[model samples]
Target: MLPLLPLPHLNREFDYLVPAEFDEAAAVGVRVRVRFAGRLVDGFIVGRVAASDHPGKLGYLERVVSAERVLTPEIVDLVAAVAHRYAGTRADVLRLAVPPRHAKVEAEPVVDPPKIAAPEVDLDAWASYTHGAAFLDAVAAGRNPRAAWQVLPGEDWPARIAELAGTCAASGRSALVVVPDQRDLDRVAAACEAVNGTDSVVALSAGLGPAKRYRRWLSALRREVSIVVGTRSAVFAPVRNLGLIVLWDDGDDGYAEPRSPYPHAREIALLRAHGIGCSAVLAGHARTAEAEALVDAGWAHDLLAPRAVVRERQPHVVALADSDHALARDPGARAARLPAIAFDAARNALKNGLGVLVQVPRGGYVPSLACGKCRNPARCRRCNGPLALPSAPGADGAGTPTCRWCGIADANHRCTVCGSRTLRAVVIGAHRTAEELGRAFPGVPVHTSGGATVLDSVASGASLVISTVGAEPSTPGGYGAALLLDGWALLGRADLRAAEETLRRWMTAGALVRAGADGGRVVVVAESEIPTVQALVRWDPVGHARAQLDERIEVGFPPAVHVAAVDGSSAAIAALVEEAALPDGVEILGPVDLPEGQRHPAGGGSGRDDGFDGDVQRLLLRVSRGSGAALARALADAQAVRSARKNTESVRVQVDPIRIG
Candidate 1:
């Protein structure tokens, strides 16, 4: 029996007796219960042997959990491969592959799939893109191809994705399209419905009820859907005769799984394509450094558009520091939250009966609170938590400071460094921006969108819409003007991807503004010379990503080299690193302690600058790309040895972590 237990010591299968009553249900892939460790536990039946292999008598299975053959052989192999590659346990990967079984859903009726023929469109529709037709034709002819696409602005990307999916379906092959989230999936699903019928595609997501999710999963397994569109987990959808896989907006953090092994959606999609010998397309508005690495390694072709065409389609972006020279003489321009140019643009847009969009860094009133005198961040004395102002204004029109981690009020607290009781907002949020804009533009309506009450789109009107990054809503005719605030908060992050991620976020919101020829303007309040700001102004995300990749290669950072992170107690991490026999060209860095504090998305880590914790430390291992497999095996062996010895120390191994910090 294939035991479900994931303990490192009991990873392999064992022999078990099948009673006569349960013989009919003892099929491969069926879950069964057996007596293990003096109690009943679930296990899968992988194979039936003619005779017992063990020398001694074996124990009988407690009972058959279900008769459904849910674990397919192909999926089992994929799970095993992922576990080995990440130095993780097979059972952990299996948990991500299959969800809890719902017996009642097994009897539900399958919906009949809609029948619709693929539609033919003009190849000129891909005019802005380079070699677009070649990629599509290759997929249509069932030629296994791979590409990394840098999508241009103002392009009908969803329609193009649908065209590709329809081409595969017309060739008698199934396709999978994985986007970042449900909203993006909805957009692609609509485009697919226009090309193929609504019934030809099915969506799989964990957001649905257990019964509904299971029903959709079963449909895909039964080959009832020709096209599947979903978020990360859909990479494993059992599409019969799979021929193509597409990953959209690969740079979005939503594509990164937070669970054990932490397999990225893009990597999983790449693995599926390579294993099944199918076409794969990785497309994003602002490509990531990792994608550029694939192109450098000759694993995928570079798909790009000409600079002239891109500039023409992009909005006229200007940095305040470059456009307003006289303001620098005022001595206060460096400290001004909103520059004069940005304020003027918003005022003019309102006067013309046009909408204005303001993109803030944080979501609430004040995500970071600091002392007014010393500029040191305020913290809770009880738990050492970073203090934040209440999301809403207080009864007296003042802000109340509260610990973000421990949820304790500290309105009367004083700064330990400078003994100042007055607190100021170090990083402003959407609510505060709305309050300021409402007062600045009197009689104009001010709408806010962020958190759980985010709006999809706003109607055309002479108003101001304040939203945080990634929460900016669409306008009917596009916003007449946009103001990108708090550029320092995004650029000052200590993480490696801070600049790249900031550019991506800025471009995503900037793309919503009307073109410059149509009287639309974008004003970024930041230093003009910064690489990220310059990239946004010139609309050159691909160039910036290429430069970033080159830097990483020179410094032996990730993508150029394979990296793994081990986190736990300092002793445990150090022990694991020393015990593992890493391959040549592999090096270890750091046993540094991670700050224990409440982490905010926009701002940097929250805590005292001098605070230190010695309990938990993180260690990173780097190896050449070719020696990655050897490193994985060595780490796994080390873990096995430790487990066998019943070591009290616990360590968590993660390959290709999203953030090294």
Candidate 2:
């Protein structure tokens, strides 16, 4: 029996005796309540054995949770593999894999799958990319073919993904497509339903309350739906005869789970594909370094359009730093937030009765501020945290500066440097940008999409849409032009994937504009010489990803080497390192104190709050690619040791974390 316990030492399966009364109901993969350590706990029957390996006598299961089998044999193996890869407990992975039991839904009779004819395959859609049609054909032929697809700018990506699903379903196999957000899920699910019939596809997401989520999950579990499209959590959906797994925009931070184990959706999809011998497609407008690594390793082929086709589909991208000529054209181009070129692009789009999209890096009114005199970053005196103006100024044109990290407002503030009291916006946000654009272009309707109020789509008429990254709204006929403002805000982040992330967001917003051949334009407020901006201008995501992978290899970062972040009390971190049998060539980076905002409150347990007197230190463990599995095993064993000793200090071990500074 696999006990539903997240403790590291008890991560393994346990032996249990089955009572005669529940013999028939206690089949493999069925949920059951078992007596573990003097307490009744939930678990699943993973296997049946006639002989006991344990020297001690086993206790009988208390009762069967339900006769319906929720866990599948395939899922059991998949979850185990995921746990091992992530240095996490199987119970932790299983929590993400299986939804909480809904007795009412479980008791409901299983609905029979509908008999719907698969829609005809649209080869024309795949014809744009080399080998794209062949990839679909292989899926239809029941053969696994992996590819990292770079989607064209003007392509109907959802429809293409739907076509792939339809082809797979036509071959009598299931397909699982995982997107990053509800918006993408809705679009892809709608397209899948249109191609494979409503009954054949089920959309899954956390936004759906418990009952609805379990209902949809049950549908897939019973094989009533051949296509499952959902957000990150749906990667573990138990679809039968899985033929294909597709992950869209794998670089999006939404794909990273914030909980324990912190598994990425892309890695999960790849693992599932490998285990099931199924086809895999990593599709996105901007490619990730991890995806590029797959291509470089010859594990997957690149599906890309020709250069000519790409040029025709993408917008005419321009960067303000492209030339000194730009500075001559507009003397204040380098300093002005919205220079003459941006104004001209917006004016032309508005004159043509087309919508305009303004992409901002931040979301609030003023997410960051600085001393107006010395240009020093403004900080809170109480907590020494960054200060910001979250809303517009008062009637007297004065605004209270509040600490972003700690909710304290500093009415009487002074700059540590130059002793200045006046403040200026270091980073502008979507709301403030909207207000400014409204004034810049009088009578032109301006809308903001970010924070609590995000619009899914806007009318394709003459108007301005100001949105923060990842929250840009779509229009019916596509926007006429796009303005990517404040490039430094995204590019200057203290992150390894800053450039890649910035490019992905830029490409996503830029792709919503009309084709450049038809007058679509994208203006980026960044240096022209920067590789990321140049990649966007040249419409070369593939090359950019390849370059990024090469850089990572040179620097020995992720995708080239395996890295784990261990954060906890200094003693706990040191103890873990000393306990673990670290593989040879493992490089230990630090045991440095965590940033002030990231430090945990005072605690003394090995759970989420594990730390020392509210102080947390982080250490990075790096190993060669071939030693990744060893590193994971070593970390898991160390964690198990701590759990066994009842260590009061909790430590967080995250493998291949999304960000490492």
Candidate 3:
């Protein structure tokens, strides 16, 4: 029995003895029910000890939650470390480690997978993966212990994923692969089913019917098959003998588990693998700075195709500048930020017999409006409602506009910043862009992407399709030319990782362009070529990330320096930050207010701000690299002090947030 004399004020872990009957059940990595404070609570079976110092009064394990060991030794220890750093509960972290109960399998036995040869594949993915078989062989064998494989894009991605699943099956270990969205998950699921007909391969998504999803989850745990593929939450899947973990587009926000103790899929997968010593891969078309950092730090290896093996030929991308001093300007393209060169490119592509893809800003008709002179979005003085073009036709055939936030009419309203009656569109949404495209190409069939109507539309071959970044259609022969409009909005996002996010979005959309249109052209709308543009220009993401990392190190960012975020009311956040322990290495930034109208629900608070509930905001705490773990330890200490308050308030601890400000 554990010693209960020194009662920890905190509801923390207590060491206890294993009852004789439950001795076998008390082994490490198992789950157990425990009696605590006159209530039954769940606790992880961290260990089974021979003896304990506490008296006979010490409580016994109520029951084993599961007959099978849910956590590996590595995960148990990793969770402990995580708990210490983030001041998180072991139970909460365990919830992340174990996939949902429905996703857990129990009865079925794993079966041997059939042998498969190196694929005689066809894919023109850009990553210099020209030497196809060699890359496939390396990935199949799990040759690299630290890193997983990234298949060069093309039709072979699906085939390669199945092949990897087969290898996991052969190893007698279950596998899990994560993608950015449900659509990709469906594609992967279909591909896996074609190769392995059993229930072993299933996709877990809340969008699917509860019963059906639960069935798939159970099948995976039972080793009904040996692999599970899905979005973020799939990382928690409790597959047995996990041999491999794969994350596609690790950089995408979709992988960030946005909940209590928000755990990212990549970090979770890495932790799980470290716990079990399993092999894994961090793969994507273009690597992010974080991924590149991993490769550079020797934490993961880069599995790439030869320059000739993959999609070496790219769309002829041109960077267009649109200042007052442009040599040529197209009258039709003057609306929005469409440069004449981009319009000319699209015109040529259509005339030359290839379809063109026009990328726009927002999906709605009028996302925002502004004064033509001041460039300020027209908003109601009483409320911050954005004035936008209404769906209904205007009185005289022109569309009427209204404010979405406050439902205020803007049909006769003039610009607030400038007194001019004539208002110009500050941000041309997807609908506006489609309208412009329709007007420009009168005879061409103009399809729009984004929002409800467009996202639901089935993919059809079109000559001119206008779409938002993610909603770009997957056209046959691809678009002859792709134009990324409204470069300012993308580059001007208020988020800290704006540049990184913009680049990723652009690259993902750009990948859809056909390789042969006007020699395959992609026109970027930018003044000067930024780093992201340069990376796209040279297709050197690896180098791009490396450079970014070097800059981060020089200027203290994650993977270089340690940082923690304390989010709450102004007083609460400030109190915690002040009380936080510092071993002379950590630094703090910003009790600063969050970006206007952008604070997270947990991120904001009302500090009696002029009698209105306003944001409490967040502060960034930075620590020296040497004391990275110590910084986390400090935050835990601070959290303890704040928890003892009579006035209960929420204080959040995040170890490494994806978004850095």
Candidate 4:
């Protein structure tokens, strides 16, 4: 019988002897139902054995899931290495490697895939691709552009991408392309279909129904499809003769799995490509330091467009930093979504038949509020809470909003600083932006892109679109102007990556600016000259990443040191820290309390600087990477030993966490 374990559980893999009664059912890579400690569990056969590890008798293998093996030898080996590197169990890594049994077992009708079947065919699907055909051809031939590349300025990208997909189809090899999210998948998938034709491609995503997902997965493993495109988890799609691996937005946090081992798609791509020696491209308008590191190490060539091409495509972005550049800028443009100058710009663009994209601080109607007199926010009388918007509309055709913490109304709100009750909204959301623009532009249809909505809502016309970061809407006619607002929202975060991250966001929003006859107007409000701002103004993300790395190297931050986070109750955290067998040279940033205050995203960890408990625990541990595998191993060993002790489970260990204060 198979060993019993929880869903996605690691630390256990059962060994079952093939029973003479059903020897046909047992084979490497086949899923079998097994009797675990107290219950039936689903598990794959990593190996079949004649003898049992346990002295007692072993049970017969359960029914086989399928005859064809899905866990290819190459992938299993990769899992082994990952298990060792992350100091995790085999099951943990495979949880990511293998699809959920439910998602697979319950099947659905397979859609006919599109084909630009030959990777070398250039069908002009990618809008406005200048050298897109040539670039696609080169990538298919396993060549990388030695120069910088730019996103061609229009709708032809589909044809360009389809023309290139021909390369994969030609070699009778399969391919997997991973983007940051579902929207990108849609954009690329359409292009793949247009160029490749029908039945030649399939999309693998968690978004699909389980049964249908499993069918596609099984088909891919059996080499039925030549191209598989998806988000992060698709990294493990079972494509046969894997030929090409393409990843866009490598720096996106969405690509990082929140589960154990926290394996990132980028790391997986690098390893997968190396294992198969397939042609690979890590492409995005912005570059990550990790990608730059790959370039520095001679792993991949830097695909780029010429400087003139970049200049022509991207607007002449300028930073508006007052001497110090409120460098502390708000992202939502709360003070005024349309400051006179920016509003005027938008008006001009729209009147001229150009679409405009307005980025807001948050996605909802009201994310934050404060008192005008004292700049203190109103709170709920029932609970020590900040206010929030409700889901249903109020009497005024607006949704009801309330405080998430201590659920209460702001009818009796007050400003503690001045002992006054006059409170004003401090932050603006996408909904508010839409509302305001609807009134300001009068009859200019405004759409929104955020949360679960796809980018398709945005149409090809001179309409206004309000968006938040990742969900920026795409325009068919393309945007004539884009308002990148609330610089502080991007800059003021306490995390180290705040500036770098914010800059990337601004550039991403700004990238949608229309290609003007001359250089277009891309006015960024953050103070100029700050590295991140400069990178935006100059369109130099690569340089920005490198410069940021240099700072990290100097300060011994990540990329220079290995890091981990242990957060929990004060006693539990203290106990773990005291008992931890942490390696030497480890630095602890805090035993300091996380906010025990009212609930809110900003309240993740309350501030003692203001009014917050200091007893709640959170701390950062950093060790030099120069220590090599030995150190990582030792640390993981320590974490594991401590973690296995049963006391550590209460305190989470996040290796290489992105959200650190």
Candidate 5:
């Protein structure tokens, strides 16, 4: 029986004796209860043998949880392969593969799937690219081909992907699509419905309730759908006769798993294709270093539209630097403030009876606050979190300060640097931008889209729509003008992919503007000479990513070398490193101690940090591509030893963590 427990020491199947009374119910792929470690635990029946290989007495199957075989042989093998690749236990992979079983749904009769018919579509978008038609033809013929696509903005990518899926389905095969978020899934699902009917595609995401998600999962497992569209976790969807796999926006942080082993969705997609001999497509607006490496290695085709079509489809871009001589005389061109150029562009767009788009760096009423007088960052007195101003002022004649990190209200925040009592915004948010724009254009309708209130599309009427990055909505006729504000907040990030990510965000917002022929204009509020700004003005994301890739390869960082991040107590980390059998030429960075106050929960701001924990140390392991598998195996072995030795301290291991800094 494959033990359901995730203990590192028991990472494989164990022998179990089937009792005579339960002979009829004992079968492979069914859930069974067994005696493990002196306690009753659940396990999956993986295999059966007539003779026992061990001289020791085998544990008896305590009871059968279910007679239905939930796991397929293909899924079992895929789970094992994933566990091996990520240096994780098989049970951990299974946890991600299968959802909790719902008894009521399992008891229901399996009805015949509804009829699904394919629809005709215009393949002009694919034909516009150099080798796009050939790639689609290969997919239709069931030839396993790989492509790396740089999807142009406003390109109906969903419809294109659905056409590809339909082609594969017509050839008697299935497809799996893994995107970054639910918004992308909605778009993909709708497009797939247009091609392969509503019942042909099944959508899976964490947003669904337990019962609903499991029901959809079961439908996919039962081979009731030809295509599966979902977020990160759906990379492991068990599709029969899988032909094509699509990984969209691998550069997005949402593709990285935050749990143990921390496998990436891109890696999983590659693994699935390799293991099943299926065709795969890695697509995004901007190329990632990893995807570039694949193209360099001659494993995937570089898919893109012709230069003439690309230039025609893109809007004209302008870069407004902070050091412009005109800005010195203009009092409002501060780092966190808008400039006259932006104001003029908005006014012009509104006068033209077209919508204007303003992209802020963040959300909330005030995401980052500072002292009004000294311009020093404000912090909460209780938790040392960055302080922010609430939507309104308090009764004490000052704005109420709140912690953006811990959500603690600090009405009496005093800046430590300059001893100032008044608060001010260091970074303007979507709401504040909307408030300012509303007043700037009196009687003009101002709309805000961010966080939970993000809109999918907006009308192209004469108005202003303020949004944060990744939340910019589509307009009916496209916005006449766009303002990318607080560029430093994005470009100045202390991350390796800062420049690349900043350019991607800017291009995403710029793409929403109408074409140059339609009088579309985009004003980026950043340094004009910066490479990112230059790339934006030239509309060259592919070149920017290539430069970024060259820099990384020169420095022996990611894409160029395999990296793993380990964080834990100093002793635990030391033990893990000492026991690891890293290959030759493997480099180890510092085991630097991180600031306790800066260490919030893993994902984002959850609560207050009292700094009670002594200190957390982190180490980075870098090895060449040839030694990556060796390093992962050594880490897994070391973890197994630690588990066997009963080490108390817990260490977190993440392979290719999204933010290396």
Candidate 6:
């Protein structure tokens, strides 16, 4: 029996005797209740054995939870593999894999799955890419063809993904597609429904609440749905005869689980595909360094459109620093939020009766404020957090400075550096940008989409829409032009994926505009010399990703080498390192104190203040690619040792963390 214990030392299975009354119901893969250490606990029957390996007599299971066989052998093996890879307990992984039991749903009558004819595979959609047709043919022929696909701008990606699913279903196999969020899930699910029928595809996501989500999950578990589309958690869906697994926009942070034993949906899909001997596709407008690494290792082939096709489909991208002459013509362009070029683009689009999109980096009215005289950043006196003006001004026609972190208002504040009360906006947000654009273009309806009020789609008419990063709204015939403002805000982050992520957001928003042939234009407000800006201008994400991957290899970062971050109090971190028999040539970096409110890369929060009251520090462990498995095992064993000793101090171990800063 596999006891549902999260303790590291008790990760293995235990022997249990089966009572004669429950012999028929106590089958393998069924849930059971057993008395473990004088307390009744839930567990699963992993296997049946005639002889006992333990010297002591085994105790009988208290009772069977249900006669339904929920866990499958394949899932059991997959969970074990995932647990070992993440240096976590199987119980922790299982918690994410299986949903809580819903007795009412399970007891409901079983019905036959809806019968629908599979939609014909459309090869024309895949014809744009070099080997796209070949990839689709391989999947239809039951052959595995792993690929990292860079989708063309303005392509109906959901329809293409659904076509792949339809191809798999026509071959009498199942397909699992995992997206990053509810918006993508709805789009893909709708496309799948369009291909097949509404009842043929199951949509799974956390926002559906417990009951509805479990009902959909049960449909997939019972093989009633051949195509399943969902968010990150759906990666572990128990679909039978899996033929293909697709992950869209794998670089999005939503794919990373913010819980213990944090696992990325991309990696999970890869693992599941490899284990099941099925085809896998990583489709996105922008390529991630990890995806490029897969191509470099020869594990996956690249699927990209021809240069001419890409150029025809993409917008005419321009950076303010593209030419010194242009900057010289408007001397204030460098400092002005909305320069002459931007105004010209917006005016041209508006004249054509087309909508315009403005993408901002921040989302509030004045995300950052500074002293007008001394040019020093303003901070809260209570918590030392940054100060900003609220979305609305005060009754006196002037806005009061408020602490963003602590939410404290400071109406009569004086600059600490210059003893001045005047304030200036260091970084403008979507709301302020919207207000400014409304004034710049009088009578041109201006709308804002960000923060708590995000619009999914806006009318494709003559108007101005200001949004922050991922919150950009879609229009019917696509926006006429796009204005990418404040490039420094995204490119200046301290994180390693700053450039990669910035390029992704830019591409996503830019793709929504009309093609350059149709008079679509994109203006970026960043230095032309910056490599990221140049990549955007040239519309060369593949080249940028390849260069970034090469740089990571030279610097020995992730995708080239395996790294783990151990976070905890100083004593706990020290003890873990000393206890673990790490592999040879393991490099250790920094046990530096983490800044206040800074979370670990794996989503681990500040160190738990149980009995120990010490500052939290993070220590990084690096090893060669070949030694990654060894490093994971060593860390797991060290954690097991700590669990056995009943160590009260808490420590978090995360391998190949999402962020390394």
- Candidate 3 wrong stretches, greater than 4 Å: 1-11, 14-35, 40-50, 60-78, 81-87, 97-135, 139-142, 147-156, 306-311, 321-336, 351-354, 390-393, 396-422, 453-460, 601-614, 644-647
Q: What do the candidate models score in CA lDDT, each in turn?
A: 0.81, 0.89, 0.65, 0.65, 0.81, 0.88
Worst-scoring 10-residue span by lDDT in model 4: 599-608
Q: Per-residue lDDT tens digits of candidate 5, residues 1-661?
A: 8988866877877898899987878888888889888999877988889987789988799998877778778778888877777778888788778888888877766656545444465668788788988998898888999989988766777888888888888778888989998888998999998889888899999999988898888787777888899999999887788999998888887777666566788988898888889999998777777888888889888998878878888887777754567567665665436787788878988999999999999987677888889887787777787887757565775556778667787766777898878776777788877887888899898888889898888877998999999898888878999999989999998889899888878887887898877888898888788998988887887788788889999998888888877777788889999988877888899788766632433343322211224678778899998888887888888888888888757776666666675
The residue-by-residue lDDT of candidate 4 on 1-661, one tens digit each, is 2232422233556556676766775667767777666566777777766676697776666667665576787787777666555444566677778876653353444444333345434343432345555665665665533322334343244444445555766656677888877778887888887666546777888798877777778767766667788888888887777777878777787887666656678777777778767777776667766666667667766655556766677775645642332334534332444555467567878887777888765777767777768787766657767776643346774554368776655555666678776656677777777887899899887888886663664767678888888788766656777777777777877777787678667767776776655324566655565678778777877787778777777887766566666566677666656665667777878866566441111214321112222344677778877543444455455555554554323444455556655
- Tens digit per residue, CA lDDT, model 3, 1-661: 1211111125365666566787766677666777777877666665665666656666677776666666666566666665665555555566555554432334444445333333333333422453444554554565536553444333346656766665665555667888878767887778777766544577887587755665666666555667788887777676666777788778787776555455567777777676677777787666776777778778777776554544454566666543434434543443437767887878877776777777776778767777767777777655877777755356684566677777767567777667776667667787777777778878877777777754423243447878887676566555678898887788887765667667667766676776642356788886545777776665555666677778778888876776777666788777777787766856778777665444442223222111214575778888776786787777776666665553356666677777665
- TM-scores for candidates 1 onward, in order: 0.92, 0.97, 0.84, 0.84, 0.94, 0.97
Score candidate 6 by lDDT.
0.88
Candidate 6 Cα RMSD after full superposition onto the native fold (Å): 1.8
Q: Model 2, residue 656: what's the lDDT?
A: 90
Local accuracy of candidate 6 as per-residue lDDT tens digits, 236-336 = 99888899999999999888776657778898888888888999999999999999999999989999999999999999998885788888888888887
Ranking of all candidate structures by their lDDT, best first: 2, 6, 5, 1, 3, 4
TM-score result, candidate 2: 0.97
- Candidate 3 positional error at 605, Å: 16
> Superposing all C-alpha atoms, what RMSD in Å does each candidate have to the true structure?
3.7, 2.3, 4.9, 5.6, 2.9, 1.8
Better of 2 and 5 by TM-score: 2
Candidate 1 RMSD to the correct structure: 3.7
Which ten-residue region of model 6 has the weakest summed lDDT?
603-612
Q: Which residue pairs collide, candidate 2?
A: 606-650
